[model samples]
Target: MIKAIVNVSLKAGVLDSQGKAVHHALDSLHFSGVSNVRVGKQIILELDTEDKTTAMADVTKMCEELLANTVIEDYEIELV
Candidate 1:
Protein backbone atom coordinates (compact mmCIF):
# COMPACT_ATOMS: atom_id res chain seq x y z
CA MET A 1 0.00 0.00 0.00
CA ILE A 2 1.00 3.56 -0.60
CA LYS A 3 0.23 6.47 1.67
CA ALA A 4 -0.20 9.75 -0.10
CA ILE A 5 -0.15 13.16 1.52
CA VAL A 6 -1.36 16.24 -0.30
CA ASN A 7 -0.69 19.73 0.93
CA VAL A 8 -2.63 22.64 -0.50
CA SER A 9 -1.97 26.33 0.01
CA LEU A 10 -2.71 29.66 -1.55
CA LYS A 11 -0.24 30.98 -4.09
CA ALA A 12 2.05 33.87 -3.36
CA GLY A 13 0.55 37.32 -4.02
CA VAL A 14 -2.87 35.89 -3.27
CA LEU A 15 -4.75 37.11 -0.25
CA ASP A 16 -5.55 34.61 2.46
CA SER A 17 -8.57 35.84 4.39
CA GLN A 18 -8.76 32.85 6.71
CA GLY A 19 -5.12 33.20 7.59
CA LYS A 20 -5.60 36.87 8.29
CA ALA A 21 -8.55 36.12 10.54
CA VAL A 22 -6.52 33.64 12.53
CA HIS A 23 -3.67 36.08 12.80
CA HIS A 24 -5.99 38.75 14.07
CA ALA A 25 -7.50 36.39 16.61
CA LEU A 26 -4.07 35.41 17.82
CA ASP A 27 -3.12 39.05 18.21
CA SER A 28 -6.30 39.73 20.13
CA LEU A 29 -5.40 36.90 22.47
CA HIS A 30 -2.01 38.56 23.00
CA PHE A 31 -0.04 35.96 21.11
CA SER A 32 2.83 38.15 20.13
CA GLY A 33 5.83 37.86 17.85
CA VAL A 34 3.87 36.74 14.82
CA SER A 35 4.69 38.78 11.73
CA ASN A 36 2.67 36.91 9.18
CA VAL A 37 0.32 33.98 8.85
CA ARG A 38 -0.78 31.60 6.13
CA VAL A 39 -3.25 28.77 6.10
CA GLY A 40 -3.24 25.51 4.10
CA LYS A 41 -4.82 22.07 4.00
CA GLN A 42 -3.48 18.55 4.09
CA ILE A 43 -5.16 15.52 2.57
CA ILE A 44 -4.05 11.95 3.16
CA LEU A 45 -4.96 9.04 0.95
CA GLU A 46 -4.14 5.38 1.38
CA LEU A 47 -3.72 3.60 -1.92
CA ASP A 48 -3.89 -0.10 -2.59
CA THR A 49 -0.94 -0.06 -4.96
CA GLU A 50 2.80 -0.19 -4.25
CA ASP A 51 4.15 1.73 -7.23
CA LYS A 52 5.48 5.09 -6.17
CA THR A 53 5.62 6.48 -9.70
CA THR A 54 2.02 5.59 -10.47
CA ALA A 55 0.84 6.71 -7.07
CA MET A 56 2.49 10.10 -7.43
CA ALA A 57 1.11 10.55 -10.91
CA ASP A 58 -2.38 9.62 -9.79
CA VAL A 59 -2.24 11.98 -6.85
CA THR A 60 -0.91 14.83 -8.97
CA LYS A 61 -3.67 14.29 -11.46
CA MET A 62 -6.19 14.29 -8.67
CA CYS A 63 -4.85 17.60 -7.47
CA GLU A 64 -5.01 19.16 -10.90
CA GLU A 65 -8.47 17.82 -11.60
CA LEU A 66 -10.35 18.37 -8.36
CA LEU A 67 -8.37 18.62 -5.15
CA ALA A 68 -6.83 22.04 -5.78
CA ASN A 69 -7.62 25.28 -7.55
CA THR A 70 -4.68 25.57 -9.89
CA VAL A 71 -5.25 29.24 -10.60
CA ILE A 72 -4.95 30.31 -7.00
CA GLU A 73 -3.63 27.37 -5.05
CA ASP A 74 -0.47 25.28 -5.19
CA TYR A 75 -0.16 21.71 -4.04
CA GLU A 76 2.62 19.34 -3.07
CA ILE A 77 2.32 15.59 -2.91
CA GLU A 78 4.32 13.20 -0.76
CA LEU A 79 4.17 9.42 -0.69
CA VAL A 80 5.11 7.23 2.19
Candidate 2:
Protein backbone atom coordinates (compact mmCIF):
# COMPACT_ATOMS: atom_id res chain seq x y z
CA MET A 1 0.00 0.00 0.00
CA ILE A 2 1.01 3.55 -0.57
CA LYS A 3 0.04 6.84 1.01
CA ALA A 4 -0.35 10.06 -0.89
CA ILE A 5 -0.27 13.43 0.83
CA VAL A 6 -1.67 16.30 -1.18
CA ASN A 7 -1.32 19.94 -0.31
CA VAL A 8 -3.64 22.46 -1.95
CA SER A 9 -3.13 26.17 -1.80
CA LEU A 10 -4.16 29.32 -3.63
CA LYS A 11 -1.76 30.62 -6.23
CA ALA A 12 0.33 33.72 -5.75
CA GLY A 13 -1.37 37.06 -6.59
CA VAL A 14 -4.70 35.57 -5.55
CA LEU A 15 -6.51 37.18 -2.67
CA ASP A 16 -6.87 35.03 0.43
CA SER A 17 -9.92 36.31 2.29
CA GLN A 18 -9.97 33.52 4.85
CA GLY A 19 -6.33 34.14 5.66
CA LYS A 20 -7.00 37.86 6.00
CA ALA A 21 -9.86 37.23 8.35
CA VAL A 22 -7.71 34.99 10.52
CA HIS A 23 -4.96 37.58 10.49
CA HIS A 24 -7.37 40.22 11.66
CA ALA A 25 -8.63 37.97 14.41
CA LEU A 26 -5.07 37.32 15.51
CA ASP A 27 -4.32 41.01 15.57
CA SER A 28 -7.38 41.56 17.70
CA LEU A 29 -6.01 38.89 20.03
CA HIS A 30 -2.66 40.78 20.21
CA PHE A 31 -0.61 38.61 17.86
CA SER A 32 1.03 41.47 15.98
CA GLY A 33 4.28 39.87 14.95
CA VAL A 34 2.69 37.43 12.52
CA SER A 35 2.26 38.34 8.86
CA ASN A 36 1.13 36.82 5.58
CA VAL A 37 -1.13 34.14 6.93
CA ARG A 38 -1.99 31.85 4.05
CA VAL A 39 -4.55 29.09 4.43
CA GLY A 40 -4.20 25.71 2.70
CA LYS A 41 -5.62 22.20 2.78
CA GLN A 42 -3.99 18.79 3.16
CA ILE A 43 -5.55 15.60 1.87
CA ILE A 44 -4.23 12.19 2.88
CA LEU A 45 -5.09 9.18 0.75
CA GLU A 46 -4.16 5.55 1.25
CA LEU A 47 -3.96 3.76 -2.04
CA ASP A 48 -4.08 0.04 -2.65
CA THR A 49 -1.00 -0.02 -4.84
CA GLU A 50 2.57 -0.60 -3.68
CA ASP A 51 4.44 1.13 -6.50
CA LYS A 52 5.55 4.65 -5.76
CA THR A 53 5.46 5.76 -9.42
CA THR A 54 1.93 4.48 -9.92
CA ALA A 55 0.74 6.07 -6.71
CA MET A 56 2.22 9.40 -7.69
CA ALA A 57 0.67 9.31 -11.16
CA ASP A 58 -2.75 8.34 -9.80
CA VAL A 59 -2.70 11.08 -7.20
CA THR A 60 -1.54 13.65 -9.71
CA LYS A 61 -4.38 12.74 -12.01
CA MET A 62 -6.83 12.95 -9.13
CA CYS A 63 -5.57 16.38 -8.20
CA GLU A 64 -5.73 17.67 -11.77
CA GLU A 65 -9.14 16.22 -12.40
CA LEU A 66 -10.99 17.00 -9.18
CA LEU A 67 -8.97 17.70 -6.06
CA ALA A 68 -7.58 21.08 -7.06
CA ASN A 69 -8.69 24.03 -9.15
CA THR A 70 -5.79 24.30 -11.57
CA VAL A 71 -6.85 27.74 -12.77
CA ILE A 72 -6.39 29.43 -9.42
CA GLU A 73 -4.88 26.90 -7.07
CA ASP A 74 -1.70 24.83 -6.94
CA TYR A 75 -1.08 21.36 -5.55
CA GLU A 76 1.89 19.36 -4.35
CA ILE A 77 1.81 15.61 -3.97
CA GLU A 78 4.01 13.47 -1.74
CA LEU A 79 4.13 9.69 -1.86
CA VAL A 80 4.96 7.69 1.23
Candidate 3:
Protein backbone atom coordinates (compact mmCIF):
# COMPACT_ATOMS: atom_id res chain seq x y z
CA MET A 1 0.00 0.00 0.00
CA ILE A 2 1.02 3.58 -0.58
CA LYS A 3 0.09 6.81 1.11
CA ALA A 4 -0.15 10.11 -0.66
CA ILE A 5 -0.12 13.37 1.24
CA VAL A 6 -1.36 16.34 -0.69
CA ASN A 7 -1.16 19.96 0.42
CA VAL A 8 -3.21 22.56 -1.36
CA SER A 9 -2.68 26.30 -0.96
CA LEU A 10 -3.71 29.46 -2.69
CA LYS A 11 -1.21 30.68 -5.23
CA ALA A 12 0.82 33.81 -4.69
CA GLY A 13 -1.04 37.06 -5.42
CA VAL A 14 -4.34 35.41 -4.59
CA LEU A 15 -6.37 36.94 -1.81
CA ASP A 16 -6.89 34.70 1.22
CA SER A 17 -9.84 36.02 3.18
CA GLN A 18 -9.88 33.14 5.67
CA GLY A 19 -6.22 33.59 6.44
CA LYS A 20 -6.75 37.30 6.93
CA ALA A 21 -9.62 36.62 9.30
CA VAL A 22 -7.48 34.28 11.34
CA HIS A 23 -4.73 36.86 11.52
CA HIS A 24 -7.18 39.47 12.72
CA ALA A 25 -8.53 37.13 15.34
CA LEU A 26 -5.05 36.41 16.53
CA ASP A 27 -4.36 40.10 16.84
CA SER A 28 -7.54 40.61 18.81
CA LEU A 29 -6.38 37.86 21.14
CA HIS A 30 -3.15 39.81 21.79
CA PHE A 31 -0.97 37.67 19.57
CA SER A 32 1.66 40.11 18.45
CA GLY A 33 4.34 39.95 15.77
CA VAL A 34 1.89 38.31 13.41
CA SER A 35 2.42 39.30 9.81
CA ASN A 36 0.84 37.58 6.88
CA VAL A 37 -1.25 34.46 7.25
CA ARG A 38 -2.03 31.82 4.66
CA VAL A 39 -4.43 28.94 4.95
CA GLY A 40 -4.12 25.58 3.17
CA LYS A 41 -5.62 22.11 3.05
CA GLN A 42 -4.12 18.68 3.41
CA ILE A 43 -5.46 15.49 1.92
CA ILE A 44 -4.20 12.02 2.78
CA LEU A 45 -4.96 9.22 0.37
CA GLU A 46 -4.25 5.53 0.85
CA LEU A 47 -3.85 3.50 -2.30
CA ASP A 48 -3.86 -0.25 -2.75
CA THR A 49 -0.92 -0.19 -5.16
CA GLU A 50 2.62 -0.51 -3.88
CA ASP A 51 4.34 1.29 -6.74
CA LYS A 52 5.52 4.72 -5.71
CA THR A 53 5.71 6.12 -9.23
CA THR A 54 2.15 5.12 -10.08
CA ALA A 55 0.87 6.48 -6.79
CA MET A 56 2.55 9.80 -7.37
CA ALA A 57 1.10 10.14 -10.85
CA ASP A 58 -2.39 9.18 -9.78
CA VAL A 59 -2.33 11.53 -6.82
CA THR A 60 -1.06 14.37 -8.95
CA LYS A 61 -3.87 13.81 -11.40
CA MET A 62 -6.39 13.75 -8.60
CA CYS A 63 -5.10 17.04 -7.23
CA GLU A 64 -5.13 18.73 -10.60
CA GLU A 65 -8.55 17.44 -11.56
CA LEU A 66 -10.61 17.51 -8.40
CA LEU A 67 -8.73 18.17 -5.17
CA ALA A 68 -7.44 21.60 -6.11
CA ASN A 69 -8.28 24.53 -8.31
CA THR A 70 -5.22 24.67 -10.52
CA VAL A 71 -6.05 28.16 -11.73
CA ILE A 72 -5.53 29.69 -8.29
CA GLU A 73 -4.20 26.98 -6.05
CA ASP A 74 -0.92 25.07 -6.00
CA TYR A 75 -0.52 21.55 -4.71
CA GLU A 76 2.39 19.56 -3.39
CA ILE A 77 2.26 15.76 -3.31
CA GLU A 78 4.23 13.54 -0.99
CA LEU A 79 4.29 9.76 -1.34
CA VAL A 80 4.94 7.39 1.48
Candidate 4:
Protein backbone atom coordinates (compact mmCIF):
# COMPACT_ATOMS: atom_id res chain seq x y z
CA MET A 1 0.00 0.00 0.00
CA ILE A 2 1.06 3.55 -0.57
CA LYS A 3 0.19 6.60 1.40
CA ALA A 4 0.01 9.86 -0.45
CA ILE A 5 0.25 13.19 1.28
CA VAL A 6 -0.48 16.33 -0.68
CA ASN A 7 0.05 19.92 0.23
CA VAL A 8 -1.67 22.72 -1.63
CA SER A 9 -0.86 26.37 -1.26
CA LEU A 10 -1.73 29.59 -3.02
CA LYS A 11 0.53 30.50 -5.88
CA ALA A 12 2.93 33.36 -5.65
CA GLY A 13 1.25 36.79 -5.91
CA VAL A 14 -2.10 35.32 -4.93
CA LEU A 15 -3.89 36.93 -2.02
CA ASP A 16 -4.55 34.80 1.07
CA SER A 17 -7.36 36.35 3.07
CA GLN A 18 -7.83 33.26 5.24
CA GLY A 19 -4.18 33.28 6.16
CA LYS A 20 -4.41 36.94 7.07
CA ALA A 21 -7.37 36.28 9.30
CA VAL A 22 -5.56 33.48 11.06
CA HIS A 23 -2.51 35.66 11.49
CA HIS A 24 -4.55 38.40 13.08
CA ALA A 25 -6.27 35.93 15.36
CA LEU A 26 -2.95 34.55 16.49
CA ASP A 27 -1.73 38.03 17.18
CA SER A 28 -4.82 38.76 19.26
CA LEU A 29 -4.07 35.59 21.19
CA HIS A 30 -0.75 37.19 22.13
CA PHE A 31 1.40 34.96 19.91
CA SER A 32 4.60 36.78 19.16
CA GLY A 33 7.37 36.71 16.56
CA VAL A 34 5.19 35.67 13.69
CA SER A 35 5.93 37.89 10.72
CA ASN A 36 3.91 36.29 7.95
CA VAL A 37 1.55 33.39 7.56
CA ARG A 38 -0.05 31.51 4.69
CA VAL A 39 -2.74 28.90 4.80
CA GLY A 40 -2.75 25.76 2.69
CA LYS A 41 -4.57 22.47 2.22
CA GLN A 42 -3.39 18.99 3.14
CA ILE A 43 -4.78 15.79 1.64
CA ILE A 44 -3.82 12.31 2.71
CA LEU A 45 -4.75 9.42 0.43
CA GLU A 46 -4.33 5.71 0.80
CA LEU A 47 -3.72 3.67 -2.30
CA ASP A 48 -3.61 -0.07 -2.85
CA THR A 49 -0.50 0.01 -4.91
CA GLU A 50 3.21 0.42 -4.16
CA ASP A 51 4.41 1.30 -7.63
CA LYS A 52 6.12 4.62 -7.11
CA THR A 53 6.01 5.69 -10.76
CA THR A 54 2.36 4.87 -11.25
CA ALA A 55 1.34 6.28 -7.88
CA MET A 56 3.18 9.52 -8.45
CA ALA A 57 1.62 9.96 -11.87
CA ASP A 58 -1.84 9.28 -10.49
CA VAL A 59 -1.34 11.66 -7.60
CA THR A 60 -0.04 14.35 -9.91
CA LYS A 61 -3.06 13.99 -12.13
CA MET A 62 -5.34 14.10 -9.12
CA CYS A 63 -3.68 17.28 -7.91
CA GLU A 64 -3.87 18.96 -11.29
CA GLU A 65 -7.43 17.96 -11.93
CA LEU A 66 -9.09 18.21 -8.54
CA LEU A 67 -6.86 18.90 -5.59
CA ALA A 68 -5.55 22.25 -6.69
CA ASN A 69 -6.60 25.22 -8.76
CA THR A 70 -3.56 25.42 -10.98
CA VAL A 71 -4.33 29.02 -11.89
CA ILE A 72 -3.98 30.11 -8.26
CA GLU A 73 -2.55 27.21 -6.29
CA ASP A 74 0.54 25.02 -6.30
CA TYR A 75 0.77 21.45 -5.04
CA GLU A 76 3.38 18.95 -3.95
CA ILE A 77 3.02 15.31 -3.00
CA GLU A 78 4.89 12.89 -0.74
CA LEU A 79 4.52 9.13 -0.75
CA VAL A 80 5.04 6.71 2.08
22-59: candidate 3 lDDT, tens digit per residue: 99999999999998999999999999999998888899
Candidate number achieving the greatest TM-score relative to the actual structure = 1
Model 3 Cα displacement at 32 (Å)? Answer: 0.3
Across 2-72, the per-residue lDDT of candidate 4 in tens digits comes to: 99999999997899999999999999999989999999999999999989999999999999999999999
Local accuracy of candidate 2 as per-residue lDDT tens digits, 1-80: 89899999999989999899999999999988996899989999999999998899899999999999999999999888
Strongest candidate by lDDT = 1
**TM-score sort, best first:** 1, 3, 2, 4
Of the two candidates 1 and 4, the one with more favorable lDDT, higher being better, is: 1
lDDT of 1 at 65: 100
lDDT of candidate 3 vs native?
0.94
Lowest-scoring 10 consecutive residues by lDDT in candidate 2? 31-40
Q: How big is the positional error of residue 29 in model 2, measured in Å on the Cα after superposition?
A: 0.7
Off by over 4 Å in 1: none
Summed backbone clashes in each candidate are: 0, 0, 0, 0
Query: TM-scores for all candidates?
Result: 0.98, 0.97, 0.97, 0.96
The TM-score of predicted model 4 comes to: 0.96
